[model samples]
Target: MKKKTFNVLLLSVLLSAFTIACTKDIDFNQIDDFEVTPVIESSLIFLDEPANQFLEDGVEISSVQDSVLVEIFKDAFIKEHLVKAEFVFETTNSINRGIELRIDFLTDSNIQLHSFSFAVEASSTNTPTIFNYTEVFENNTLESLFETGKLLFTLNLKPGPVINENTPGSIKLKSKGIFFLNIDNTL
Candidate 1:
């Protein structure tokens, strides 16, 4: 009887210890931050690379004889491609000095001119065409910049004083690219 009692007691103690040890199954993987991290960051802008795009029609002065040569070809190419202008010249009562010439330009991204026109080469006659041009220029009294990359301007064809030295003064001014002409801001 005594032995049986002792054995039973020992068995019971052992069972208890085993149960206690088995109940805890925690091993959280030594988690300090607990995983789940997602943070990434990596980030440039300065521009002026417009080499040329606004040369829609810069030097259009087929040819003019007088009226200050249309204010000197509107001060060389449509008054610097003004933000306003619409002149359509056409005179032939006897050609006292004013032939047909059309203009409609308003350049500089604001975009207003799609295809302006201008030509007058008839100092006496003989210029069906060939003084290519667009219109718009800058530099008045200093500091003019029509993008200043190169949109040259100026069409000085004079027969205005009625001179006869060849009188057929043909005006000219082609533009597409390249500038820096007659550096005089009208000063």
Candidate 2:
């Protein structure tokens, strides 16, 4: 009986102490000043083409073209919050021929918004040659990036040794895009 009475007394004291602790009133208006900056990284393209793909009917193709539809820019929320964008491309060439890569950002009507190009050196041996390129969009360029609806990639083969279906190497490309956004919540 005595132990049970002591436990009840201790519980009552702890509850009273917790109730007496003071807390300041929260200001809900502070939420209006909240802002957040977020960075998003996404894979944009990956191409691994064998040398044979560049040959058609025993003739070496001058260029290979590909395009991807970009739908993220269609979002109004993303457009309003986007502040900057960066695109990074890495190419590995094991073929014995130099290549030029051209990237174009286009609108829904097929109008070109932005374009850039970079060259990758030819590999002398079976060893691969690597090239890295980065394109940053800010200030005026950010607006052009937001208007992009499609991305076109063109790979132009440079004059070199003849490439046949028996060619021993391939060309690999990896690319990504980083987007920076600033959002503000105000009531």
After superposing all C-alphas onto the true structure, candidate 1 shows an RMSD in angstroms of 25.9
Tens-digit lDDT string for candidate 1 (1-55): 9999999999999999988875666787556434332222111011111111111
Count of clashes, each model: 13, 0
Q: Please, what are the lDDT tens digits per residue for candidate 2 over residues 1-187? A: 9999999999999999999989899999988899999999999999999999998888989899999999898798987888988999999999999999999999989999999999999887958999999999988888888888999999999999989999888999999999999999931
Error of 1 at 99 (Å): 7.7
Mark the 10 consecutive residues where model 2 has the least summed lDDT. Answer: 178-187
Q: Which runs in model 1 stand beyond 4 Å of their true positions? A: 1-88, 92-102, 109-112, 116-164, 168-187
The alpha-carbon lDDT assigned to residue 108 of candidate 1 equals 39
- Candidate with best lDDT: 2
